[model samples]
Target chain A: MSDLFPEEVRTERLRLECESVADADLGERYASMNETAIEDGELAYVPIEPFEHLQEARDFVAQREDRMESGDAGTYVVRPRDGEDGAGYPAGEAELFAVWDERTAFMTFGLRKRFWGRGYSGERAAALLRLAFERLGVELVSVTHLVGNENSRRAIGKYVDRFDGERVGRFRNQHVIDGEPRDVVRYEVSKADYEASGERPDCEFVEERADGGDGA
Target chain B: MHVGVANLDCLWENRRVHTGVSLYRPYWGRGYAGERARALLSVTFDRLDLDVASVAHFEGNENSKRQMEGWVEDFGGREDAYIRNAVPRDDGDAEPWNLRSYSITAADYRDAGGAPEVELDPENVPEPTSEPTDLDRANDGGDGA
Candidate 1:
């Protein structure tokens, strides 16, 4: 897992690049994005609190780097490849958190308000799933979203199969949204299922090296 | 003779735990396994304050599967996943055994009237033996199903 990190994944329109300590400024921007309400009156549901200062953002990046180094998690920043004027600086982030036994991982993705409705969420999520199933050799990937989060439900529904009914257990009132207890719907996608579906995203992963050589 | 003991593996971050129980062959038909499971479930949900609990049994282990299903019916639990070829058999040459996982939440446990009071009668309890018996030999199969 450590050898797989610090790599670059290129989708058709988005670049899902691994995050490092050098991306502290981008982390600060992400934190700021979460602090403000979006156009839909929805606040980003983040496990951690919004960063109060640049130092906090830097700390967050540092911790993420440590987790990546330990092979416990991976974080990627989603951005446009062309870097055109109209293109956003950094759309949002995608993560494969809580990797266990090299076979299972928890996936999450978020996009800023300005970046929504541009098909960026689905693109980044597909690329992240490729990274999990192809490069990381993970067998099962699980995701959970707030029940009322329609945007998240739609985005995640495109990439994975729903694991509700008798197939998966529900965690009732696992989160509190707007001072009310909300159930989180759990979803999962197995490597076999993903491979059988024959729905591969147009993505390529390139390993980066400390030297000036392309580690493909 | 003593049958088996049920235990819990604590996973606090997910607010969940894994339950395991193994019984000797001589005590298989008896209700010792179920009795032990009830006590462990009480400790897991009532005392530990966990959100969910899970258990798994290997393929071809009908007795173990039946025991787990009984808990699901009692606690309104669900069969989570049917993991194919997940558990390897004791013999390396044998095909890997499929795994069936079941999970129960604390809310469901309460909805099923919760764990019953487990009473132990000292007079009926079997005394521990210093020498290894058939129970010890049976337990050598594995930690749990």
Candidate 2:
């Protein structure tokens, strides 16, 4: 289980890279995010700091290393094929994170406003599901949607099966964005359901090799 | 048959009284159906520690009824509890229906042989945690969506 985290995942259409401090303008880019943009998006919550400054974002990524080591946290960058042009959104569609046992991952996608109507969200979600199951070996994965988020709910429903009955629950104010202290609906997918979905489990994966002379 | 997964999700395995049997047409007349059913009997009678296993067949499924009859000769005897429409085949598109049952015991399974062994990786089992944590993580096996 400790070996579950992978630094990068390259699917057919997009590349999912876990962000570190070295990555581009994460701080300033994330800082540039306005509260309105986040509220409109119905994200978990907008951070207190107005701008996502370099040090702030770097420290965030650095804190992730500590969290991950203790099996408490993880974050990844979604890089879509269409490069991030002028808009500040990260190129990829979304990211998955599991803090502790990593039983199941919770995912959130970030397709830019321009890419809204495209079908990339579901496609990328399926790819991420594969990573969680075959790669990370999770038994289940669940997603939460803010009440009234019909678009996100529909997108999520079209993806995973096992649609466990929804339980209204509360999440963090700043950590999750659906707004302050709001109740959300939960949906989940179990390994049994995912395997039963008739999707192919036989995709060939090219393991990202590490540098260095190796003669194992 | 594809054995629609939807049926399983409905908790088919937990049903107190349900029986389903299928055989490939290509493998007919080879007693494969009987063998298939005896396998389930072994699971119920042996591994499940059930005192008896109930099996059934209807008027149209003579092959299946015959299979159950054979098992009785080996270890037990049977009597009809009631004539019932276990599965109605009255519909034009449906198949035939007849019903019968049997009881197999753990003792019988032990006498015949044993159930197959299963192994699971102990490490993968997640430890449950209280529900108040904010990280979507508990002691371990956490989620944060």
Candidate 3:
């Protein structure tokens, strides 16, 4: 297993940092936003139950940190670049997880309702794709959205090559939205497709090491 | 002793299996690959009662591409995924090859009259060679890339 992705990525308006235990407060905030989104029927694909307490958020962050250490997955906290200095809450999350032998990974992201419609989702997703292809050497990245999630579809479409048709599969009631089962739409982008799109995020990656050595 | 071998990697949870086949160079172009694939598909669909069976090959491997096409045309398989530069070549200078994956469902397999029959002759099987070929390593592990 290799730690190929950098610790932090900065776009023009957002900074995507690897989630850590120290970011428990941010995690708590994210959990609250997720709960709101779910309750409002704006999000339906999340499998886990909403967090009831801050402790759950801390535990989630700890588990993510462990997965990052094992090189299996990573979750990034999306925050404003010019936001407050310390203990700032995350506006959203962009995650690349379920890495398969460093060859492929799954992408998922969301923005807080307050941050929606700001074009930040596209920026953050582009940055994550760049990290997946350039840093992790992944050949393909996949994303899925439940049917009727037009916002997610649009956000993910920004990075995908439209020439390749999306694959639709029946989840057989996998997602219960408004008490009805819905199918899922899956989209995949290959490294070649990403390179061909010529859409690169204006971002800087900052590598942070735990051993006090400059990441080379 | 072996003229070739076929493999079925069952993903029981997914109700699918991944198939792979390899033959000695001298045995190539004899339609053995297709026959072995049919037999394996039988095991996957009939014996294992699996829902889907999938296979993949590098883009440049015309033999494999042709065989997969045969299965698709005859057994109603469909192209499932194509990942660019997914299969790294053994030669360091050569570029990584694109991978084309295909899948067939048990319903399709049954509609195609199950699996084709292949004759087996244990008496003519050759002794195993000492040297390990790239295909051997690929078939043994490492995602059969």
> What is candidate 1's fraction of native contacts?
0.04
Residue-wise C-alpha lDDT for candidate 2, range B21-40, written one tens digit per residue: 55435656776555555555
For residues A1-216, write the lDDT of model 3, one tens digit per residue. 235667777788877777667644644555665455445544455545556666777776777677677776666777776643322446677778745543677887866556667778778777877887887777777787776777877876665643232443323223445545444566777778777777676788777635322121
Location of the lowest summed lDDT over 10 successive residues in candidate 3 chain B? B124-133
Candidate 3 chain A, which ten residues in sequence have the lowest lDDT sum? A165-174
Poorest lDDT segment (10 consecutive residues) of candidate 1 chain B: B125-134
Q: Where is model 2 chain B poorest over a 10-residue stretch in terms of lDDT? A: B3-12
lDDT tens string, model 2, A139-178? 6666776666667677776765423323323221112332
The residue ranges of model 3 lying beyond 4 angstroms of the native Cα positions read A1-7, A26-37, A40-43, A46-49, A52-56, A67-74, A80-91, A96-106, A110-119, A130-151, A161-200, A204-216, B88-94, B116-145
Instruction: Pick the lDDT winner.
Output: 3
Q: Which regions of candidate 2 are displaced past 4 Å?
A: A23-52, A64-74, A82-89, A99-102, A161-179, A201-216, B1-145
| TM-scores for chain B, listed for all candidates | 0.76, 0.51, 0.75
Query: What's the TM-score of each model vs. the native?
Result: 0.70, 0.45, 0.67
Task: Write down the C-alpha DockQ for each prediction.
Answer: 0.11, 0.01, 0.06
**Docking quality tier of candidate 3?**
incorrect
* Top-DockQ candidate index: 1
CA-lDDT, candidates in order: 0.66, 0.48, 0.67
Q: lDDT at A193 for candidate 1?
A: 74
